[model samples]
Target: MMEDFSGLALPPLFGGHILETELDAAGVELTAGTTEILESGGTPQDIQKDTRELDKRKYQALSKRVKELEQVNERMLARLHRVQRLTRRLKKERRFLMKTLDTYGDDYRNAEITIPLEDEGGANLDGIPGGDDGGSSPSTTNQPACGPKKKRHRVPKEKERDAQ
Candidate 1:
């Protein structure tokens, strides 16, 4: 395009512009020159530039990873809830077993059942079997019918020494 450089006014800051032109493949000539006065809308090419490439595999992998992580989190939560339930069940079973043992002790104390064995003096000890031997008395394993209040043993009484 042949630009008429005669009518163009150069701003005072840039002094003046020297016009130059070149022809394109379509025989349409293009002008090249630096102008001091700035225009409202400059070149259309200056608006934007594209540098994008498509990659579907990268997006698919990211989505798959997110889904897998979510599934793992769900499984962990379920396992934690199951563990809590099992722990509660175990504690309940333990308490029930202790209560059963206490009931057994009560039944024995009331003489609901009898076991046969001789005492230290060849006497038959009541309730449970396997009492102390005649020569050396065995340690007592019988729980008191009334049971202990504080559940602790006091120190044994000291034996007195005989003076000559």
Candidate 2:
């Protein structure tokens, strides 16, 4: 009976070969040849495993970077909030200072230095020589001696008086 090799997917039966399985040097040579083929086939699988390992490393690095960016974003948000609060406080202080300057009009100087607004008697000075205690200063020499004027409200005349 002729054996159908095409239908048999298995390797040739090792027992059917009359050749010696172990012929010293010849056996070693055949085994070495088979091992070389198997080693070549293993290369593609190794390359695939290496590619997967590289991809996993890249993903871990990107994840670590994202976490660092999130931490930076959180710190920036906190700083922005603190700056907003400080800005609000500075604005309130500026308004209060402006109101104070308006109340002390005429006695306020445009200089960038802080000068006392009151004397020993707690009276506002008008920067004039002989104006308060008769002491003369350079700022008082060219300016007139004028105290801050009290704001006044004029009441409307009565309707009967206007008619008359």
State which candidate has the highest TM-score: 2
RMSD of each: 34.5, 32.6
Model 1, span 59-148: residue lDDT tens: 444465457657867888998999999999999998888789787775533556565544446564554467534443333456556767
Model 1 poorest 10 in a row by lDDT: 47-56
Q: lDDT by residue for model 2 over 111-162, one digit each (tens)?
A: 6777675445535366544446644477866665586567998776899578
RMSD of 1: 34.5
Looking at model 2, report the run of 10 residues with the lowest lDDT sum: 18-27
TM of each candidate vs. truth: 0.31, 0.39
Candidate 2 Cα outliers beyond 4 Å, as residue runs:
1-43, 106-109, 114-164
Error of 2 at 39 (Å): 12
lDDT of each: 0.47, 0.59
Candidate 2 collision pairs? 130-134
